[model samples]
Target: MDSRRSPLGRAALLLVALVALPAAAQGKKPKEGAYVPAPADQIPGYSAKVMPCEIIEELIPPRVNCEGELLEGKSLRELAILRNTIFARYGWAGFRKPWLRDHFQKQPWFKPNPKFTYKLLSDADRKNVHFIGVREQSFTERELRRMEDTIFARAGKVWNDVYEWKLKDGRTVRSCAEPQDPLDEKEGCTGANCEGTHSRDCFFREEKWYRPDPKFSEDKLSAEDRIDLGLISRSLGSFASDTGKLEKGAQASLDRVISVQELRQLSLRDLRLLRNTLYARRGRPFKSKILQAHFKAMSWYRQDPNYTDARLTENDKRNIALIRSVEDEFGGPLKDEDWLIDPATDAA
Candidate 1:
């Protein structure tokens, strides 16, 4: 039927043609080998605002012309997704396409294309990109070594200056002191008559001087010089002798000894009795067993009775050697009473 012949027929034909136009367009597909640009919203699950500089910078990784001009924007996750998508679809050939290149260059949010290349990014940036599913080149051994050396050097510097002290009241403190101000005094100082003089006597109220324990010799400083520098802790020094002896399995050494505070509270007679008891118990297996049981009740006892010198763990042996070395400098065990006596009162 010729729909154009009459008014009614013509009106019906126009309606049919209008309905067929959309269906015909829908059936048409893109030609093979044609480059269809990915839609802006093609990347699913990513809706964050992307900066043009981030895209351009990632695209040109071999040069560094974009510094300072790149806007500091958010949505790093979305940018990463976009970067990977473009690279996967077009490779380096995508940048050669005028349309694709112009699309990024015309972004009004950033300046015109800043020249950059993949080589321009730092190792950290490379790692970040790789973490986002980009296959980046692995770091060479030399680069890895440089990073490791930097870490070790920083750690060594921190450890070399660190010092720890064990105080008379059974407290441990750590410090990082230089030779000029080894005691780390406050700027103005404290206590009575300390305003004018920055002397140790005026600043240190507890004793004429305090010394750090020998265990702190793990630093670069020599143990003897460190002790002479008044870094020794009284409580630690007092126990040092006995602790050193016990570690070496010395027959004369007791498995347990009284703390400085405990010894201070004892009467003269009690002190003598305790010493005699220790001397009598020396080298006696039954007494050793009894002492071991008593030591086990204390909070500080870590070794099991079954672990002897022959069966000592590597750590225990190392500790034994350290204590032995330090004890050799003292000539013998350093008892708590040696440092506890008030020399002023005794002299009178």
Candidate 2:
């Protein structure tokens, strides 16, 4: 039943009036009381019938449910800075501000670095910055093992769904190698029709030919695949939180250290996504960092999987390997050359 309305129905009248009011009459601005609706027809060539109806959720505040003391939560100021910086760097706009703020500020280990001053760099100072201090949460042996298991389980599904099928025709046209038949035509052994008994002495047994199916090649994971992947990732995140092993709750705010060689092995698209994400975290422009990340990831791939970088999981190694075949073919990574924009000299 509509609790917003009182028994007298006066509240219902007030609510309807509030909803029907224009933006100018709302009288409240963001951070004050309520979010006013932005006009839908403000865009160029806008039409009411052709345009989609969008609900502005910010107008309604979220209901807060507290289990016990609100003070029991973790501080996440550092995580907020990281998250904000990433979005700003990537030129991405219109993210859910409240969600971003809440996610970052809720992490167990996120604390404000008051000593650090936030700096917005111009075209200059692109490459001079070195050695950004990134803090990663420490996971206990149990937590690490759990994460490893979760990653393996998730990747296993992807591998099976994407690439698990036996060739139908067998190896090659091989004849009967049974001692009873030897190399006779009566023994269901023919060079063209039977398993290649004729090539018993061949280096590789290619006698059994396999007929590859185009339908099998056409099969692919769809949107459900990503949903399943996200479920596994979220489960892993939950495990991290349960074990007190998270510096931040926001997915983009994690300061994970992945090797260059490791990045090289992921699918090219995935590698680019990761690289873009990392670039956003750095508060720097994306240049040749993709190439650098890919190269470094490959270098790491050549070594043992146990190498500790906090970022390289066994699953990442496998994923990267699948994507490493694609070439970057882009310009070399960003340069440190500073082109000074003189205030006095204006020649445009």
Backbone clashes counted, model 2: 31
Cα deviation of 125 in candidate 1 (Å)?
19
Tens-place lDDT per residue, model 1, 93-185, is 223223234434544322221221222222332223323321111122233223322322322322222344343454444432222322334
Cα lDDT listed for each candidate: 0.28, 0.27
Of the candidates shown, which would achieve the greatest TM-score relative to the real structure?
2
* TM match of model 2 to true structure: 0.18
Give candidate 2 regions above 4 Å deviation. Answer: 1-81, 84-119, 122-133, 137-141, 144-321, 325-348
Q: Report the CA-based lDDT of candidate 2 relative to the real structure.
A: 0.27
Query: What 10-residue stretch in candidate 2 is worst by lDDT?
Result: 339-348
